[model samples]
Target: MTWRARLLALDGLTPQLGDADRLVWTTLADAPDGAELVFLGLDDGRPCFAAIPAAGDAAPRLANPQLWGLMARLPAADLALYGGARSLIDWHARHRFCAQCGGDTRLAKGGWQRDCGACGAQHFPRTDPVTIMLVEYRGRLLLGRGLGWGEGRYSALAGFVEPGESLEEAVAREVLEETGVTVPSATVRYIASQPWPFPSQLMIGCHVRASNDAITLDTTELADARWFSREDVATALAGKGPFTAPPQQAIAHHLLHWWLNQPATA
Candidate 1:
């Protein structure tokens, strides 16, 4: 019973397992020293681990492709595991020293925590929460484009949740701040969530009802903001519209797809 190892590079690419049906696990004796190891639970009673090599050191025969490119190409389960692995590896790399006392830190709790040598403080990985909402008003959805997203790329409005604020509160605040559309607390509804691991973020998806269709775009935050009807959105999703929506891997796209299929209500 060989334990499976997924050797990930600093850039997040893993070794391709050739045409073999399963991964080729490198035993502890074969793993390189200073490689960050994380136990990723078990697959069919065999232990599965994610290994990240030290910076500037190459892993054996692994391709160095970008992780974002593999999201849609890999199976859902595999993608989820890779997301977790990438996040944990990134956290460890960034927290090599403790912030409290500027002391050295070492891995603890099976790669989930860091222990300080000087200050004796324990540090843990952080996951920032963000609220992404699809705002609706008068049978239309509000979309906005960030400053550098090119001419016609629009998606749901999102912002990080501030301290001491509820999810509903964050939703309303982000909507107003980015698009100047006022959404009351009662009209905000939670839909679903997705783990965004670019550097560890939990995206909370919601559908918000705007009090009015009027939009006042904040130029510093957004390049453009507008309300799109269901017909327009459907056309965009079908790749026939003037503007393009988010990609399939994003929660924004999922929220839009869900909203497009719902029956209109008074």
Candidate 2:
């Protein structure tokens, strides 16, 4: 059976298929042929996977990419919930130490909290804020190409939230810092969110109205930057662009898709 997309959320995770204990740590196991493992991060004593091909069938299946690609297909609720589990598990695996003092931390409260043995400090899982926005002006969207991505691939502008700022402020600051475009307060609208676990990030998607159209590129962050009409964006989404949209599973892609489907307001 074709695997349907399910979000990773408190409500998204259903009960286990059976009472037999499941493995949490990564292990080498012999998966039956034509099966794909959709790894659900560990919670308390359980780790889950939406084991595809429940029984016997013959077809080529996904490896790791196919597993992660599941995010794009799932609803925001499910993605947020499932990604939450993944992030929590990942944080638990890494935060075995106290940053305040060189102390060891022990897992407590079913993998949610880490208690320090040396200085009595408590640590929790983190969700690093990321501002992902579609900067709009004159019926065009601002796009950028990152250094690490393939050539001719462009997506919405994005950056990390600094120490003392809200999500809207981060969107404005990131647009200015990366592309020298000023985003207005009235136009910064929240869209959706996604769990990006390259190393634990919560990507907050938004639509921003730019005060100016001209771009001043910050070479360290973006290789190239420019404005594209909705038509141009539509072409790109259709896989005909010199630059393409981000992966369909990403919040960036969702923002862009929504923008493309809307009537031009600016």
Candidate 3:
């Protein structure tokens, strides 16, 4: 995966096998010294592997880069495999030293763990939890855009899940912090989750009911925010509205669609 600013991602390693089907097979060999090869489990009884090229490493040149379209249409299983490989490889690259004692680490467990020789510590890949919420008022949904986002493009508000906070509490706090809208923990509802491979984050999607439709801007966190009606959201999903919704690949898109389908009383 190739990404810039954590959003514009291209599955440059994937190639199309059939009509709109993605396969993670690559012809790149494990070469040029110090390349990290990951054993990414079995695929239809066949072992699969991924190669992460070391800095300044020389790889075999390829005429066709095997780059594919946006990953939104990738099969779920393939996407999961890609995500796992990316996360593991990234962890190996970044965590070469043990945090506990600042000792050099060695790979173990077929690329699943790192062992520190100096401090006798073991480390594993970490997945951070983030809360993406559908903040709903009586009949509207709150959407926000961070600084530098394209004008008129808005999606669900989200923030990292702080330590010692439940998912429900995280949802309420994120909503309140970003938009200054009070949503009690009791009114927060979990909707779904997805594995985001942009440096390995688990996006926890939720719905939160706000007590009122009031807005206070946190300029440091958001460039703009507003509550759109069901019809406005529906229009946005259909490609014409006051603001554009996120792409289909994002869990936020599904959250908006799910809420739009629910009865008004909900």
lDDT of 3 by residue, 183-261 (tens): 9899888899998766678999998889977889899999999989998999999999779889777798999999988
TM-score of 1: 0.86
Listed in order, each prediction's TM-score against the native is 0.86, 0.72, 0.84
Between prediction 1 and prediction 3, the one with superior lDDT is: 1
Across 1-266, the per-residue lDDT of candidate 1 in tens digits comes to: 34444343323334333233222345555556767676767767666666654532233211323434556565666667767876777677778889999999988887888999999999998999999999998898899998877688899999999999999999999999987889997888999999987668899999988898878889999999988889899999888985798878889888988998899755
lDDT by residue for model 2 (1-266), tens: 12333322221222121123221222324344543344554444455443322322122221245444555555654555555555555565566679889698776764567889999999887878898899998898999998766678898888999999988889998999999988886779998887786457888889988999878999999999989998898888888985777877677877888998788875
Model 3 pairs in collision? none
Model 2 segments more than 4 A misplaced: 1-82
Top candidate (TM-score)? 1
Evaluation by lDDT, superior candidate among 2 and 3: 3
Better of 1 and 2 by TM-score: 1
Give residue 145's error in model 3 in angstroms: 0.4
Candidate 2 residue-wise lDDT at 128: 88
**Clash numbers, per candidate:** 0, 7, 0
Q: What TM-score number comes out for model 3? A: 0.84
Name the lDDT value of residue 14 in candidate 2: 24
